[model samples]
Target: MKEATEGRLRLTILGGFLGSGKTTWLRHHLHERAFGRVHVIVNEAAAAPVDDALLSAADRLTLLAGACVCCTGQSDFLRVLLGLCDDRSGLADPSMRVENIVLETSGLADPAAILAMIQAHPVLVRQIVVVETIVIVDALNARTQMEQEVLCRQQIEAADRLILTKTDLAAPKDLARLGATLRAIAPGATLSAARFGSPLGLKDPWSDDEPFALPEISEHDSSPINACQLDLGDTPDWTAFTVWLSALLYARGDQIVRVKGVVVTPAGRLLLQTVRRSVQSPEILPESATPVEGDNTIAVIGRGFSQDQLAASFNHFSA
Candidate 1:
């Protein structure tokens, strides 16, 4: 582990299920320029990373690829975090002090597990203080996911602020029901709604004047959820792809917790993201964004699906 820096560092975790818009919220935060010298740690399980493309230009961003931070990357998480801060040795430059650290956990991460790791680590306990655990919930799918996925419930139960993303697509009654359900699960958490990341109160953790309260670590069992990716040799026709996806979601969306990927579509480079049955409109990536070959891939993280079933679903669209 890297040596710890002398000054206090505020850390916040941006946690949510896949396709719940964690990255979108982070982009909005960066645009606000609310924090000074904020450093971001993006934990991704994909073979090809995407958030790095979205957040690379920020003050400082590091990608910890190939594992979920709450699980395989816990030690790596500490290492990268400690590395970002200058060691207390006077030899380190003064300008190297990091004011804040934001960690965006993978969609399937367990926030309690993350909290447990931090609370137990010796270096982290002394150097880093948690400001908030902001959990983004997809309004359209919250009820089903909360009821079906233990990890989703754990994340929500562990949040200091629970943000409901993509509320515009939900009907008033449905949104109301979702709110009631969330309150039932996490009555103490602060709730806010967002459409395209609006009203996102992401700020420097220390800005809050109240005494910081850490969320309780959930005691849910840590079970493995399978994440499978399929490489689409080329972008499939948008019309056909949507039709296929709609059908798939209609049939098995309950089993598929999250779907996300990049595609070089005829329209342009696009990012497709979804949680359960709520699929956001494809985001048009800037031409400067890292280019993906015709080898673009889509990842599905869920339960009850064999790898072959997942591959066949994507391959069916390919034909």
Candidate 2:
């Protein structure tokens, strides 16, 4: 895995409004045949359990929150990242072996702040290469929010690729209205529709003739502080689990920018992780904290997520 840092990381930063289907879209992205080994940094504003469904994928997930990457992104980003760069840390995936990274920003994150931070981070600048920026817009609110919400506009205005999600929930004409507004904001970006199975060119932001520019330096992607860890006891009725998870999310959804953790259950241990919205599939890890190279431990990074609220949902244990 250390060898991966030496070449093209092809890192893509994912941005979107809350509940715009970013995580669901990413879950679908995991099965891609062309995708090499992937690493994710989940950032949210509050503490919430990771989507247990992802536990089936091989373990390679990290959580960062209670402090956001947008604000503390420089320190948290490098610390978690260095773990992957060092094969001794045991967080990097052993298979496929290419260290392709994806950073999922909070719903309220400004792409400009995120990019400038990454571009300037001393370790990251020397270690990784950013390939593109992808922003997802909620079809239901794009128009209204773009006109009224400062943060919403910033997210759209800074994207390299603008993806409209939840189109199916709106009328054809309404969807067009949303698209028109997004075009006005991110005129230089490739605008596409995203659904399960197909990425719909979200990764391919523009043509060779088009250019991907960086967001301004004045903006910051920081959010409030928060974190979460969910304990499912000794076992779980995994099929019926999404209910409490949904409740926990709604409790602090507005405050959450990222969430990540692993759940140990009788059904064989499974890992869990989530960015404020999008999540990566969890991989299996050894049950004990022997620090073996193959062990799985989940972590998240987000903005303004209260530690007290997160504590109610989950607990911290020895690694």
Which candidate has the top score in TM-score? 1
Task: Give one digit per residue, the lDDT tens place, for model 1 in 1-319.
Answer: 1334356677888999777889888887887875566888999876567777788546888888768989887778878867754442333565766678888999878887887888798877777777788999987766556655677888888898888886766766666666666766787788886766678442231222332123443345334666777666654676766777788888888677777777777777788877778787788987745555422677777767877986687667757
Q: For candidate 2, lDDT tens digit of each residue in 101-124?
A: 777766656767877876687766
Report the number of the highest-lDDT candidate: 1
Model 2: CA > 4 A from native? 1-6, 51-59, 88-96, 197-319
Local distance difference test values of all predictions, in order: 0.73, 0.57
How displaced is residue 8 in candidate 1, in Å?
1.7
Runs in model 1 lying further than 4 Å from the true structure: 1-6, 86-93, 200-224, 234-244, 293-295
| Sequence-dependent TM-score of model 2 | 0.60
TM-score of each: 0.81, 0.60
